[model samples]
Target: MPASAFDDLDSYIALPRVEALALSPDGRRAVLTVAALRKDATGYERSLWEVPADGSGGPRRLTRSAKGEAGAAFTAGGDVLFVSARPDGDDAPEAGQLWLLPAAGGEARPVTRLAGGVSSLAAVAEASASVIVSADLLPAATTLEDEAVLRKKRKDKKVSAILHDAYPVRHWDHDLGPADPHLLALDLSALDDTIAAAVADEAAEDAEATMDASTPYPSSLPRPRDLTPAPRRSADVEGAALTPDGATLFAGMRRSLPRGSRSILVAIDVASGERAVLFDEDGVDFGEPVVSHDGQTLAFVRRDRGSAERPFDAAVWVCALDGSGARRVAADWDRWPTQLVFDADDTALIATADQDGRGPVFRLPLDGAPVLQLTDDHYAYSHVGVDRARGGYVALRSSWVESPHPVRIDADGAVTPLATPAPVPSTTAKLTEVETEASDGTRIRGWLVLPEGADAATPAPLLLWIHGGPFASWNAWSWRWAPLLAAARGYAVLLPDPGLSTGYGLEFVARGWNAWGREPYTDLMAIADAVVARDDIDADKTAAMGGSFGGYMANWVAGHTDRFRAIVTHASLWALDQFGPTTDDSEFWSRIFTAEGMASHSPHHSVAEIRTPMLVIHGDKDYRVPIGEGLRLWSELAEHHADDDGRLPHRFLYFPDENHWILSPQHTVIWYQTVFAFLDEHVHGREFVRPELLG
Candidate 1:
């Protein structure tokens, strides 16, 4: 048997990871973006690999550079288009630039050299070589040349400030920006002509052998046409698709309001650069646009804004390209679809949604028939790309037992995994399902991971792992919070999806909507009670831990009960009234929570009741849950529990440079180290051994 990666943090972090998949138009090949830990072990670098869609051959590396590449899309000619910050000649782009890997198989060449490098491939025409990419452009610049000059001036003057006239000045981790994103269109023929001229000039010089990296491509390339000009701050393109002929583009554009913004679908003429609103309504936002094979129909997701009384609802909607004949798909279905793509036959649409603790693929017909599930498994599927010609699909599937990898799904729901360089890591832990009934008679279920020798004779310590999102499920695998690591330390971890978790019907979410401390709290306690009753779990030795909304629940659990020996909260919501207006997006938070509801559920009111030791972790750069929350939490803990000598049983781990999540490689290792140490001290009655790096 193979060794479990959880045995060693270094070995676990060194494992190769795969993300994102792009299938060719003919469904012959797939390009996967795989990230491997760098040689220095400071970060991970991504590379493109070609995998045979038929599963006949092994994966082959396509591109290699220090800067790495991602966001791959296939053009009509089978060429792979990706964005990378790799150097061309002596100049390294400040941002990622669009690069093309030719179908004929030579060397990847740069396509666009803009002041703000291309960010992502927006849309690719099926019948034409034209492509659209999203890039950031200064609002003051009218042309690409003008933008270049303005950027140079700013760099020379060392001006790092941005004047915002909008509601949200910052997002989750970073500032919103000095430049807004715009969609740019490029004609491949013009680029081809320019490349031909450069090659001819090099031949005329008769210096092919001497053609170093400095002069491989021409200095003057055809500039891309800016499809969106003067978009200001409202140009956040959420999703986009192009017509078969590349003559029209349908995109979800964010419309800025006095306090916030809402997304609306728009159609832009490819040639004339004219845009018209295709769908816009009050109190609703639309995104994830997809066009059919024939380009006559459009599909997108419509989200009805939520209120204090009820949570928001998302529905699949389809209409013509001209914005007529709009109707909801599968109106009777309770599942909320997250992805949409037209199948080969175009008679039905293929989509994916969370269901029964897993996100499975489904086929919904245009005639409003019953929705049919395409995949029946324990894995959650994402990045679904439909095979237009063969009526098949390619996607990335993952579960609690395995990491994400590329797979091909047939029309009959058969799945064949494509070759990947990363092999699934083994673990000594075992997974099993546990369910119980809440006080309200609602069924609550979760996954329990047990260490290798756990039994009635030697019951393992328990860890109640509450998932964040309060709206997310515990179906998918997560590197950040892998339960196997705890199992490797002879601990059992329980992952419970309580109320407000998706996949469950809307009614289940509503049970905890206005009353966060009610159903969600009771559901978690109910599931934990059932698990602790098992002979293989130690009922007296347990702890509760969570982050974000989960963190809120952990605090609530601490104040309401004394069952758990310890608690861990990360980026938590300590005070409802202070948090509502201080978060990154106040409008969305305020709309969903009323003053009365917040007061009734606020965890800060119970601070005086908390008796369990706690570990509070937060990032200073986290704008979503500001650092003030952690500071307030630490202060309250001291004021309530500290002795005359100012000593308390609580600890606060702060990261000044990290965002909401600990992203750096070293920092992530420290995060796990501190968490394990804290748990050992409180739950296992072991001495509190502080991590060496913290000192």
Candidate 2:
């Protein structure tokens, strides 16, 4: 494919991608979720695909449904188990439910028919047939049938009300409750045996039912027992892994604290309803638990809450199964560990961390040795599946230049491609790494994408794109804020990692902690100045854009300087005090920020100083930086410029159904088109072009 082909937003969104890889027990086969455009090209649909662990043949599609299949896992017998919303021909609920595909390659059939439907899946290591599923339950309903009846009653009454006692009534993009996520365990050993015998009996009675059937034969499915009993309000368990013996389950559980909520590792007895906190420490958060194959050792990531002087630091900690001898591993490693997994023999750990300019995989030894850096590339890896039997691992690798695909990495640090669903469009621009020194002499770095025709004589307009997460880095590929799309439009895109970005050590992050307008703001300006000085960049045509925390910075930049021609802030925080009290996870932020700090740093407090045209974009369902922020920002901009005689050009783009991100394919196209039009009008002195779809 020519690089120009992907220059179109439609073609870019149509690219086939894969994520969520799960390797089988014997390391002979793996399954992953592949997302492709639906038939009408309106949106993407995800389906499960299987590939060989030996990296021989291409991936084969396993399940196809309108609802799509995800959260894939392999059972002990090598059968594939996944969650889907596909309706059974009969009376199945409309939510996601567990389905099983036989190991020998047959029809995928429903494994569990719960009322709330399965949200995620986990299998017992020692007993592969045993599985645990998470589902939503009404506040008082105890059983699946009761929950189903309650849902029906609510539907019949057309009621949509929720009662909450907590400070937060919603999450990133959704309401927190009427129902809460609950975990249930299903011992499928007896059901599997019964189904096998029933199938044999059916074959003898009716040959047609045993052959070419699209669904599994009707058999009695077992009732899953509730592991998280009632009375445990507001308890959330996720990332659960069963022990090798299947006697205990270790998972990350979030419990309420005085200030907020903190995640801790909990060990639950598989048979009894007893649970114990395995690792708990004050001023710390623990999660992502991985147990060794022998079930003797546990490895998890521990994050130390930041102090007034330091930022948050994450490190891998290892402890015995009995919750003793807990010690930090690779204490000197500067990078924060994520997506951790234990090797088969339990001697070492494989994990991914944001490092420098990329998210790289690292192998950390349990004996406190230096961490080994594996896979030296610009791409980032996630949903890693290890094949200890084959002495290798498979992960979904992605980069700014390409979408994610499944790749295999061997012990010798060799990366082999496993599946290629679609061709990556050739780029119309080249990516280069650029660095500059902050005001404090601290080194700052970022990626610069220069357009195809950009040069000394024909300079391109620059877009200073700031990443979200004041805590995250722009090290991975993002379909939402793609740089290639901007490059194709004859723009040089600058993705800078300022203060509070990961990959950099805690000290670097500390520079911006509690002080949003200090180092991070200066560092961004320093990098922008460096980019503008380049001969290939048109400094006068530069514009600034950001989302979330980046959005907050954009607002800050607008209030502090008139350097940029225009500014775009999406889902930004306008008033720190209002945002802190109303955001979905209020507790978490309240614990980290003080009222005085909020008032001092909030951009809304200094709105009168703004002197630049702006485009404000927000989604109504964005609970993280909620729609209120955008409303307040727009109001402030309007009220401050009421006497400006309409000289300042400002527009507001709103999404009613969308959340923090503009995810709909059609909506995303409009988003980019509108942004380009706004930039052209303000920065290039071109006429404003309204999006046709919006009209």
Candidate 3:
């Protein structure tokens, strides 16, 4: 909490950030998954462990993911189902295969592969039966019907500190080939006895397969009548709910397309072609709807505007079958309600709330009653589930400080811990905080991490690192490994949470409105100046680096100042004019920053001003900040173009497989290594990039 706290990355993160919790329909079992960091062969392995739901049982291992996974569910028969990356799949496949493990502990079975990738999975029961879901494999191709892949390249862009936000549109990217994602529906009946789903058959090796455009849910049971004659893709459906007789199916779709219209909720008789639009939110969204046991009421998460990381403050609203008598049962304005559950008797609503510090599971009555806590002292009590048939609740819990560990509560209220905690390398650096005044005289807060073994007797090189989310802040608790590696190499790190930082107050962050590359950049320089004044930091040898919004800032700084010896940009957008029109939030950027001003700050248009030696990393398939931006910047530098100062040297590293995020442990390590090498070469006077590492 000081200007020198960056001296070392804290070894352990704070704990008890948990999913408040979730229960099963039978109320027999529960699962608790905890997020913990552990070292594997490469480095830290963030994973999920499991345990009983009610309050008893030894912890179990559910997922051994590296970056970790979310959204774990329970099958009717009490099997645990969830999504995660698979080694057998492409690198960063991200299809999120549906994995199943018996509630009592057994080998995880891949029901089926999600070809495009299963973004979501919902379970339902019929006639007191159970269904086993092999896998709702995403279709390898959505439309082979025409014998031609209707490929359309969609380009979207944005700026990030490290260019770490979006992936470019690439032909052979991870999402290419038979991986055209279409929303598919799969229903594992009561106890998972009978299965039904909307599937796309990819059996045609050389030809396109035609869809019936009818009942989509593939099932071992008889084909349900086509409620939707047009049979739109599952991607069009946001949520699904089954009736008591398993006869009716309800679905929701995103409505912000074409012209941003109202979202529609429709009902389809699974057994007959009876379909109807129950309701529509003119300018809002109501999705992830679940039907009450009585089949007369519907509940869903409703809000206004999505896709731009909108604050997910949705309330649980229930309405009659006709879409009338709508009333909000529970709402959380501050935090997103990750999960919602209704007791079998339909008398109580168990909701997962993360409003304050962390999430905690709570049980509330449907009629009306103060919410009651079900679990205490947990951080991210999320990835929660209930295997009522298995007799407990299960969840994956994660902490902001330490690696996540899965914990569960059994029928009798006993808690069990699972998985070993992860180990992070000891930080040779110190972590501290500093406050400075921006050019506009606005107060800005920052986290300054001094290099290890550097003090008044020895000044260390400095790396002014920025965070993405002009709205996101770097506070006491945040995860950024790049600076740690730099510190390990004897360079100081400075992370400043300028105006528009969350957690402080809504008003503080508002100061950053339309102020990109201006005050925010000023804050960065101020923090650098303040830190370098200390005997422990060397100003002349300082460097700059960041991803996404941070990436954009890096581009901006490299173009305007010769202060940095070297700079690295990742998944960044360089041209604001290009980004303004393509971004999903184009209107938003225009409304807040004005379209013209945003274009003026873009680095692409001002490339002639760049002077620093720079490295740019772009994921080939990044849709958020696409690789084109990287290519643009790289090409400009390759042209040997002289800036206002002089000639600039640059290198562009393109990750063909990665998306908006870097997922491979090996790639992550290499990426950090490159960052430190660049800093060390310029800041510490050591050739940073390894010649052998580059191909």
Candidate 4:
């Protein structure tokens, strides 16, 4: 790839991306899930690739099919297991099924044939060769055969309606339907016996009968036993961990409340299918369970669901397998762990958490010692897998300047980049830090991405970009909201983590709790002030933009100030009062604000004060910040600014098929095109070039 790959949207979109990493139990091999643009350039197809865990050899593709493969894991015997929708034989189901590739090198075979298919790998036992996978099943299906019959009947009748007995009928991007997720256990150790018996019966009739029975063999792995039976909608498993012996499964299950839900940790006996509550508390939720190497203890995160007054901090808690001797570890640690896994010796936990403006790995000792920072770099780590036998870790790390790639982290905190098939694209943009003191004496910090030639003589135009999650921090590399693309267009992008952004401790988030318009807005203005004052930034040519919570802030900025020449808000909350009842999870937000408090911070009330030209973007399928908010914002903009003929200076870009994030490759290209075009017209004083694909 050329060095200017980031300059062209086509080349940028075609770049291969690494997503997930999995390590073998022996700590010798690592596998990654890499997604590349399809031939049609409409979407991404995921495939598994093998990379050396010891950082010795080049990456090699492991599996290939038109349907592709993902969710890779390793069995105790070193075989690779993945989920794919590829057709197996004449009777193969259309949904995704588990497939296994031998470690000794041979053809891959289907391990499952369930009609509903596997959703994700829940847990894998290192010693027992037992596997647990999550799958969706219809409410009435009592067995795998019954599930297949029910699915076929539904397809034959073309029935698409779903009856809802719960509060949330829709999730972030998809509808929660007649089929809910359930955990299924498969004993891989017993697979050989089942196949042998089937072959014996066939040989009894014909002495020369060959065992060529298709991809799924005459006998696939014995029908998976349903561990979570008739769980309805409450079987929402947040995280799961299996003992090394595969005798017990600790899972975080959601307990549905009258309006909302809370997660609680539970332990299930894998043999008898008996369950017991491990931990449960009011106003608190537990998740991210990880078992010790010896299976004697469990460590999980306990989160307090704060009320309308203050924000809560997430703390790490450890307990015995029987739910006794529960205690919080590293109680003074202010940062929140994004991912957790027991260290090789089981004396500590290897975790990644946001600190300052970067996400780095840390080691938390169970003895209550101070947390030790592991990776002292700018990269954020995820999909961490421990090499228990060898005493190291394998994880995928990325920064603002680099895409996610696998790396080996030694026990002494040294990071070695592993060979990856998806090479990191080169960019000319430079990254730097910027900070300022807020009005309340709090420090506000952010990242400033500058173009190559930006200097005192040639200042680059600025785009103030806010992040979503209101609770999340701008600490990691995001392919969807990359600032490097903006830098390629000769623009500087400001990524500010104002109030309510994590990693700054609970007090920083609490400062903006229930007061989104006060501290967060001012903090953003403070950082913007400090950045614009620099000699390398164009103070006059500036714009503001954000999505989700950041979009809400953009709308707030537009309503309150006219400093920026233009504004862009995507999937933002407009009328908080109307948004309360219409959102997907009304209960969560409702708990954070009173009716009066919501109306006070609402941006729709101040729409008449807006004077800058604005561009509003939304997707019809966005459930978090629904399209109704966008329509309302657009309608109000027209109502307040339209002339006699009902025309206005604002524009609305709507996507009918997209969700909260513009996921489609083609759609992402169009999104950037429209955004830059709008900024060109208002901020750069150039003619707007409409995206050709829109026509």
Candidate 5:
């Protein structure tokens, strides 16, 4: 692999990325979404593709359109149904519509044309063709046509204001406003009949009728029935699953509390419009419901709301469909399960969890047996699709060395690549895992990316890159925070899993819950010390950088020590008190922090002690940390710091349209260019070079 591969951002963004996988009912065919940069080079477009479940044939593209497709699923009949925004030639709604492609090979056609677009899709496992979808709805609108009219009227009147009686007005990156998400049940049988009639009529018109056949035929679509006809005020439902018989639907509904909101699982009868609470506890939130194929058991996650002493912990819980014999599964397993599905026999469950430094799949038995480890590798697995007939599963596998690709995991524990749309980058950097002992004797582990030509004779500069989610581990491949770019610039990047990081047990996370500036901080420094002592690392030319919680740590590091030549913080929480109240998810933070705790741990108070050169990066639409934190930190630095010249020893890079992350292709390129330039000027003692894109 050549180092020049990482030097160009265009080539990096052009690489095909794979996400989400769905298997057919028979498990012989699998479909996954692939996103690639559009021909215009402005943004990415996603399309559905089919791959052989046995990893035998080349992947074939299924759908191609200017507006791409996503949220793919296989109907019980083995037909592919996906959501897309392709425009209908007639007076159809402009938002996303459900489209279908037959398993026998045919042009994809729309199934429904909802006004506000389809947000999610689900199907019954046993039934032939029963489906449920969710879409955004306008206030007081009963039908799709009415909602469309309301949208047009609002657009004509230029009414953009949203009247909210709820506490939260915005989510992570978007406003949670005038319209809300609502569930709808699609009449798939009726839709199939309508399409069949249209095709028959065209054939009957002439025996020699020869249609273009390649182009999609738009038939009269069937209207969906509103499941939640009259939802509660500001209600937002998610994580919906259907029973094998398609008679019942289980979903998570958010209910507001004094400090925050908690999601409780509720079961809805598909035909009678009757709803019942399946599980609801006082301090524990429930979500991600998965019903067994036998329809006798229901499994979901229970998350405990934290206090100053204990932070949140997610555990898997199972209960009978009749709301009896509820118990927690995998009670002894220290790792937390994210997504799971029941095995074919319904006697065991398979799930993926962050462990050590990788996300591995685990099998938990309902018969009181010990949990079994299914996968042991450096790659992270997500969006798992199980094939009961083959007794195997497929998942999107990714690691630091490779991008996401579809891989089949056989019953015998063997993994084979199903599709590789993008080629791996050519690089000479070596990726290795390292571990060190903290002052408290706790073991800290991290991934070290040593650049090419880095040896004792020519030591490489070091960059300590901390991960966000203070709760998440660095186990997966990330194009955004890729270390290859830094390694291309002759820097060795260290991605450490300090305290509060997942994959470690609860005891490890509890070490930094209330003492954010204590254990986690020290664990990070301890690992850095171990790496700096390596013969191939330049100890003096080191820098620290992070985003979100990692950004918060970078701020803390800048103020506490002058060991690093420079520091970079992005979307960081500087003043915990102010941030706790102003953030989008304020209630979650408020529940965990006390007034004294905020005062003692916040990085804002210690800003005056900073003597290192710093680069502060933030996005205006970052509701997670909020732009106010960046403004405050920048203003404080300008007021408090002064170098030999009149200029302040700091710089600020602001993104007005971006959210917490710089997602745009050009913007991402500029981000890396600016960061490298800053590090070079400060750490390498080189002249400051401004990026051409910024100018």
Candidate 6:
């Protein structure tokens, strides 16, 4: 029997992530927006696809585009309503106009004109009576970028350099502006051979992509003409739900002030121009508030937005239509409750959870333990679609071990595969799992993959594989980059789920919080030790490499110990403290790490103590860990190299147009080739491949 095999360095380790899923209320049809492959050398082109509820039927192509096709929903008249990025006209990142198509396949019709991009939409009902749409850049979403635009217009010889230094982003990445979004309710009251609708007075920023937070209605629409005025200020109005009775609209709230969360719900009378705050709280926070089908209950996800480590362990909750009998259904559950839907009978709740490496589906009652296992195999199971007629269950899934695809889980729990635009290749490289303990007696689960032809006792040069998502797991199969590429290079690679990796439960992930540089670092060191102890591995020839969280850890490893001869860090975090103010989550470190913790954990603060030769890579537009981390580390190490011995060697590889994750196929191949050459130089005692530079 073949042991669970592993890859040297597979691209599957860092592939694209699928974000949204929608099933037609009828069940026989489902639509979803799969994330584009990171590289997209061709440019962003994500679209809507159709699948049968049974999972045995082929996936029918519904929508395709060059820029992107996201935010899909089913119209009341049994048609597909989606957003697609138009080409040639504008390169607006958020410019997708709303379009409608019959589920059985017919010409797609443009529902309305969009000044920007459509971010999301809410169907009035499966009957196709009316609809609510959201597009950022619609008037309501147009933010005042006057200052920012003016600054750009004023040219300076040192402008590019200055912008680069201030933003820590590659100049090539998409220019982000003060994004705006709007939500508009459409009146499809006409659906025969034609479609008719009115845009609410202003658009809603329901989709955070544009940062607008009000509903969009054209002047022609009745609701927006009188009293239901558009919102003027920024508010957290993310996530919306349709009441079964179809009379009222609901939205959740988020705040950036004294708390990241607030107990606020926006209740709009869909018919009248009147609206009211369903509820507001100072201590309790609300998010993902969903209006149930019966129209009597409002289901939502709630958590306390505080500095506490477990600020958002959201549980499923419900409230009466009249705002009475409020109670939580599954709040204390450890997993991050994602994609919620009431089952066909409304007797059970199906939720997507990151309990394991793959996003798995779990079924829970209004009050009880969730069914342990619902669907397994494939990358993950989420984006649930429920329709009582088609047995009412569907999911969109993808994983590090497998490409993103759709699957159907029956009432009997048998998962049948569905179709996807980009099907996972039929073949798999190989995978295996081995468990080892770290220095602190904590157990570590690691995988070892061999070159295609080489195996036991082959004495292959070793590539130490690592993963980001410090709170997430480093599992096997379909992740892109790192391991996939390493494996292709014909080296032995090993990946370990260090102490704080997810799927192991709550305590495991929480351990990574303030202990950033400690437990995780220790877990990595122990992997090298395990490899050195094995006879099949050559201790004299070994390389350390990783990206993002893994990259940061690799830097720390090389700086702290010389057990490995070569190191490469990509989109990596060097200074954890500097990460907050410049990153999307500017306040994260302030909450997770205090001044002392930041100083104690940052790799930049400790790099002078490193002895290993290194290669640093960063994308110009990466706002996550940002490019500054990579630049600073490389410059300091190089500067000190000139002053110290000739022993230390290091290089910096910057992707001009890339973000935290290198997406272009050309850049990806070039990156892999460069790092492999670097590893060859030190581990094999010679640069085996000439490094090719991309212009």
The most accurate candidate by TM-score is 4
Which candidate leads the pack in lDDT? 4
Report RMSD for candidate 5.
4.5
**Model 2, 352-402: lDDT tens per residue?**
989887988889988877899888988888877778776888888887777
Clashing pairs in 4: none
Q: How many backbone clashes does candidate 6 have?
A: 70
Name the runs in model 4 displaced over 4 angstroms.
1-3, 193-218
**Ranked candidates (lDDT, high to low):** 4, 1, 5, 2, 6, 3
Query: Of the candidates numbered 3 and 6, which has the greater lDDT value?
Result: 6
How far is 689's C-alpha from truth in model 5 (Å)?
1.6
User: All predictions: root-mean-square deviation over Cα?
Assistant: 3.5, 4.3, 9.1, 3.2, 4.5, 7.2
The whole-model lDDT of each prediction reads: 0.87, 0.82, 0.56, 0.89, 0.84, 0.62
Clashes of each: 0, 1, 136, 0, 1, 70
Ranking the candidates on TM-score from highest down gives 4, 1, 5, 2, 6, 3
Judged by lDDT against the true structure, how good is candidate 5? 0.84
Write the residue-wise lDDT of candidate 1 on 303-362 in tens digits: 988898899999998999898999999898887887898888777899998888898999
**Could you tell me which 10 consecutive residues in candidate 3 have the lowest summed lDDT?**
147-156
Candidate 2 stretches with Cα past 4 Å from truth are: 1-3, 122-127, 192-219, 231-235, 307-309, 643-648
Candidate no. 2 TM-score = 0.94
lDDT of 5 by residue, 418-441 (tens): 865554556778898999999878
Error of 2 at 244 (Å): 1.9
Higher-ranked by lDDT: 5 or 6: 5
TM-score of 1: 0.95
lDDT agreement of model 2 with the native: 0.82
Which lDDT tens digits does candidate 3 get at residues 1-695? 52332332232222222332334456544444444434442334333454344445454556665645545555555566666655433322345655566767755655434333455554454332322222222132333222122111111233221211122112223332222223333444411222222222223321232543322222222211223332323234666666655666667754444322334677665544466777675546667777666677777777654322322234677777667888777443333455775554566655676433345666656676665667665354655554435544555554333334455645344556543332223445676767767677776766676666887778887778877766555532334444555665576778777554554444454555565777667777787787878877776787888888889989988988998899988888788777655553444454456655566667786687777889898887676676777887887776656456764556666788886667555566567667666767766677655745556
